[model samples]
Target chain A: MVNKAPLLEIKNLRVHYKVYGGVLKVLDGVNLTVYPGEKVGLVGETGCGKTTTMKTALAILPVPPGVVVGGEILYKGRNLLAMSPRQLSNVRGREMTMIFQDPMAALNPVFNVEQQFTPVLKHAAKNHLSNKEIHAQAVLALQDVALADPERLLQAYPIQLSGGMRQRVCIGMALATRPQLLIADEPGTALDVTIQAQVLRLLNNLVDRLNTSIILITHSLGVVYETVDRLYVMYAGNIVEVAPTRKLFSNPLHPYSQGLMDAVPKLSGGGISQGISGRIPDYSHPPAGCRFHTRCSHVMEICRHQKPPEFEVEEGHKVACYLYGPKNQEAAV
Target chain B: MSEAILEVRDLKKHFVVDHIGTFRRQPVTVRAVDGISFDLQAGETLGLVGESGSGKSTIAYILAGMYRPTQGRIHFRGLDLFSENGKRPLFLKKEIQIVFQDPGSSLNPRRTIAQNLAVPLQIHKPDKNIMRETLRLLELVDLPAIYMYKYPNMLSGGEKQIVAIARALATDPSFMILDEPTSALDVSVQGKVINLLMRLQSDLDLTYLFITHDLSLMRNIATRVAIMYLGKICEISKGSEFFQNPQHPYTQMLLSSIPVVSKDEEKLKPAKMIPTGEIPSPVNIPPGCSFNTRCPKKMDVCFEIDPDFVEISRQHFARCHLFGQTQKQG
Candidate 1:
């Protein structure tokens, strides 16, 4: 996948922060690639850099304390990290649109739907269009998310809408440009199960229709199973496992991945999925060797002393754990 | 079974809205728990299912002696719980407990898990050795004895929840109200907590007033379920029977809307009935059936007169006009 032409290739990405106490490594040597029209689910609990990874990719991350220390974000052969200010701006929103986790917070309270929708269209457009054309585009954008009476909704404020509707609006605004890649960070969390399903279905339908790639960052395995074809399981700012969704669920190689799967509440009658026992390691001074060793049920002595090299489990499945091979032992030696 | 542990008759708890408008103090009554009646068996888990502000929480709080009902009779062991002249029963306070939604909020932040769990013991059974009892409660919820000395902030969401459950059980309550106990927890943690609750129920012979919005989870654990909508019980039936063939339109819609992750199923089966729009404000409830505003098969009569609950099956009860007519005809 890395050898092939990727829609977005994140190679050895390292995002860090300079706090008063110390330098915090939030994203350490992360590697991921999404081919054209690929739906890759980035699954992890809170503070696992799932959100940070997406935000960094979009170049929208607030950066005074935060800094991308090293990385190559190659989108369509162009290295985004090396791009000029104008070049970066041109690619962002127009080429790869992003939707935030909380729609209510993301949307402006003072502005109506029409006000927010206009700027997005104007920004996406290479040349200025007529007011009629802009209004039509705005209505169409709302309709794209399946909002009833798009014209009426366009006139309404964000406060007038429900949480599900607000999320739909956010999705609509994101898709207004028809970007090559869509980065959704916990877009469906605020919604109810039914509404969440509707939003997810709408997203999938949009992606399919436009042939757009999507990076869905979620905490729920059920959502990942439903939405994504491939999954990247993160633990303590490190990519612990990367595999196809079915394979990851069926033959979870990493102990952390297994713990996550076992922790999720399943609809079917199986025993309780035991949750990961410990909290995510503090980023300012993360543990040596395997980042997940502290919580890993099958933690070996090598895991404590040495960082596990990426081991190829099977086709399209890779795991970072000492228990996997002698390569880890050799690294430790 | 054992003379009905708690018998609620026409339980109606309304909130008076004394908002100053153009007119003299506008007295708008929010009918939180509108005329409802049910009984809890000695050791049965009665699941109350509803979306936010469906008055499920209100009902639970009222039952737990937190709020006084405006109009109703809560007869617990032949004594009225809300009567003006009635003495508040000691058993109602001690023998009945609650586990709130957010374990973080329920447990004190400053206090250690041991201290937090020991509060109920100190309040109820003051004579008992509090530290010894706290360790036993912690063990009961599967929390390690070491966590007893740790503060609530030091614990994870799941651990805090375990501590909350331990505190609730400290008084050895025969009946408990678990209001969205697992809603705030992660899935795996939720499963563990639910399993713990199930085990505890069987072991302690506990009666539960389980309130939740998760239909799938309710089906797994609840013995009997009461579907609430806009401060009213749309339907109440045995869990098995309710899942098999729900009588009310709202109940059917709610059950169908649950996301099925099993690969055997394709296309999230949309609720056979999608209730139109959002729930109407309880403060300004519509005449007749409150659900009529969103109900798909609402009739003119449904808008004019309130529907009376009719027993469709042995234990299946619903408050739709369709069932009302069948009851009159039969």
Candidate 2:
């Protein structure tokens, strides 16, 4: 896996949203990578720019309000940001696709399943396939997601389907293109726990069988712990920690990561945790240096003034915190 | 043991909806709460756990007197709730207060925190100093008195929920119904709220009918846990036993399916029970067992007859043919 070239590489991605008072610096020099057939989890709370990063990667971020100040979203060694409209469209649904948190919003309420599938299928196939061929593929996709009756579902509207079924249809539609990479932003968050578990299992199986890479964005630590191999912990628009799922859980280096892990209520009975104190920083005037320094427990003087560089704590485990830097080590000694 | 603070017996709530798509305009009955029974002891948190459309919210509404039950009876401290008339007595209403999910909507956006808190205080404690009481409520929830002047929109999601909790506390009720209280908040914020609720439970000696879909959360907070499926209780047990020895197949399935953070927690989970199908519609629930369509260990009898609640242990009860038949044979 280390030797393999990354399927998607986001380098120094800086995104800003033009708001009323000032430009909200949503993504401040964010960096992430997804290797082929790798399951990566981007975990963060609300307004932490996890969704913004993914939306930017897919070129779906609404412009005028959203402006990419600086970034390079590289897919297969080619920069996605530099791609023309036609080129991006050709690569969008066919090569890489996204599934949103709300399936209802992603799907058209007026259109039946068949009508919804036709355009996506046609787009994926580059308009080469006939209507009948697309219909057959749609049925197969629906079956793959374990939706019982493909014929009945294809004729039904989005409103008619249950939340779980609607999500399944969305998953089926997203995977129908057989994209190399899939970005699922809280795909099962809206569904019930039982239904969420089922959907997640189905997603895992489908992605595994297809040998496709996935970037699962969710706030639930448990969900990420089970699904992803590697995790990128984002806090206030910065990738604060990046490590293997097990390693991150076992020995989290960053204060925010540790706080996040401790925040979740565990099933193995323990008293409720004292959750991280303070809210996410105001993005419009995000704290300088370490954005997490405002809430971090181990806040050094230099941390307040200087942005901490990503330090490799161990092999494949990186943390962006001054506590792990040379200054802290010398002080400790 | 202290007397049960609240008792529900054979409680049922059904809603009749117009079948719009069909040729004939026929109404379909959605059996939201189908003959569920439970007893909430004083100062004990009874966690009502279930999935969406499982009628957990309907049960909460019924208990809070927001909706009348289609059938059955509810007794609060030995006094029958429905014995009087359509309107609950003002004193009874004061005894039962509820905190709802989505505090953003629950707290009136137009009203300031002080005003919101004053509504319950003014209603329940009309003679008390409203200003002083509002500040006290704020202090109770760990928020500063300065926040009393702030509008709901000015406060964060967690702060708003705290305000809602304070409002619920305003009535000085012994029984509180928390309907998915912290589900809408962030994970980091959830802990603070849960800790506050737990602290308040001990401080106030409050009996909570906690309703939520997250079973893992109930493990830490609840004294007793009840699993609801399609408006019926499938299993009920002490909190420790609910996690350690989940009896019903549906319970086992729900337990196994929960995604745990650590391998140690994973080890404690029941063996993976892959649920087969999605939850059936409440309007068209399966003939026999509601969970039969999804239960992996379902037997032939599960499809033919609804099993009775078998007392698995001293206090643990499971409604499943697997246990029902075992008890019969024994």
Candidate 3:
């Protein structure tokens, strides 16, 4: 079934960082498309450039050490990469927002919740709203997030609230503007099991009502399993697979995706799970062909020399392994 | 039951915070670990599961001799841990060791892997060959012999934790307390650490008090699981039974909340059990049942009367009013 154009589209995103004397190829030829009101999860291990992918697409990458060597980040058919800083700033708070993993770190220690939230609300303000009007808006937003005593909570500093509460406050601040898209990076990772459940549900609920699309980046397969509709499996700065959440969990196509699924211990009291054997290769001197070929169990002769193209095995499902498509269609490899 | 390797009775560790603020200067009594008791049998893994404020970590700290309990008795093979002595008996200290959560902070960054291992070996087994023992420890954790010369910063998070575990085992402790060992690790690397820990447990015949917030982790590693909520063990059951048929409402919520790979995770909506908002501060825990504030099955009596522990089935116990009362005394 064909749908309208994606709300956000990224094509051939290549982000590089200058480390010491040489340039490090962080994100290489990444592609992602997110439709409006859809939930997409970006799952990867540490140093896989999940954060870099999001930051670069959002035009928020720090440029001295980092450089978007090549890429096209399109929002509503407009290229965000080419947008000026002033135009990008306008798009950030109102059009898109982000909720960090650590809410305490995102908030200021000395300032109360009121002071920290004002700047964000101001960016989202359509007209000249008074402090009282903004306070009312903040309280309503806080109440929407199921926080009790909104006025009283506003007077307190970030340190006084619990980790879950701090995150909820951050979520409230993010959704208060009613942005079209929200980017959450490990939003529930710092929370406890029960609290993580609360935060995720709240996020899902708030976004559902507002019809806000989400780009959730997390390492937990379980988090991605329950939360997102679709997800991208990343390895060493390369997106190995992209499929519907349920489909990926049941039958993960890529070898790295399967390895990651096998690594986490299950809750069903099963026998031990096997960990992926090798460490991720150094990105500075990344291996040729598939980034995960070194750790992949079904490594092929062609996999060592040629980079696999993202081949569509089924409708809406794409995999980068040479196990399908190019190797089958060409036979020359 | 097998002879209890370690026993804790009414363990309480309450810290009074002296408030220096101008408005409220009264010292607040934070009930970090309030009246909790559990026993660890030889060669068995007892998993203590809880959130941050649930005081599970505090119990680990007390057992490790990091903090002195305000009231309670911890018997290590029938020896009182808090005997008014500034120092613990060397035998007791050497026999019981604890591994902390953050391997990076727990390990000395300045020292090489060999130097770190040698510290414990020199203190307890000076007569033995230190370098040889260090090399053996490194091999046991699956690290190469070359890693002995490298520092902690050079190793990965999973490798660093493996080294931390090796250092903990240097003195050959029979009883070990693992405090959130794998929580900080990545999913794939976390599996390696858990596998190494299990192999070590069997090889050494060690008794463990494995504490973590990851309830799913207990399904494989823990022989017996103990669910802690607000400084109390809500339920203690075999790992298989614990997930199959959890007794406490709190345990059920935690289990259902786990993000499993299967679509079963979708069935467990957060609205099903877990209450909204953060865990109440330990400084002001609720009266009656600490969890009644959030318990979906909370009744009128739950607000006024606290529940006592009772064995519901063989090898399974729950601390909830749901099972009906036995007596006023626990």
Candidate order (TM-score): 2, 3, 1
What DockQ, between 0 and 1, does each candidate earn? 0.37, 0.77, 0.63
Which stretches in model 3 have alpha-carbon errors above 4 Å? A328-333, B19-27, B264-271, B326-330
- Once superposed on the true structure, which residue ranges of model 1 sit more than 4 Å away at CA? A1-4, A322-333, B1-3, B17-25, B144-146, B264-277, B283-289, B292-306, B321-328
Q: Cα lDDT of model 3 overall? A: 0.87
Better by DockQ, candidate 2 or 1 = 2
lDDT per residue for candidate 2 within B1-330, as digits (tens), equals 889978899999989986655685777899999989889999999999999999999998988889988899999998888764578888899899899999999998899999999998888899999999988898899998899889999888999999999999998899999999999999898999999999999999999999998887898899999999999999999999889998889888888888899987998877767755788999899989988888878789989999998898989998999888877888
Candidate 1 achieves a global lDDT of: 0.83
**What DockQ would you assign to candidate 2?**
0.77
Best by lDDT: 2
List lDDT for all candidates, in order.
0.83, 0.92, 0.87
Which of the predicted structures, 2 or 3, would earn the higher DockQ when compared with the native?
2
lDDT (C-alpha) at residue B216 in model 1: 66
**Position A175, candidate 1: lDDT:** 93
Using all chains and alpha carbons, the TM-scores for the candidates as numbered come to: 0.90, 0.98, 0.95
Q: After aligning candidate 1 to the native by TM-score, how far in Å is the CA of A182 from where it should be?
A: 1.6
Ranking by DockQ: 2, 3, 1
Model 1 chain B: weakest 10-residue lDDT segment is B262-271
For residues A1-333, write the lDDT of model 2, one tens digit per residue.
999999999999999999888999889999999999999999999999999999999999999899999979999999999999999998899989999999999999999999999999999998999989989999999999999889999999999999989999999999999999999999999988888988999999999999999999999999999999999999988899999999999999899989888888889988778799889988888888889988888898888898899999899999999888887899899
Winner on lDDT (1 vs 3): 3
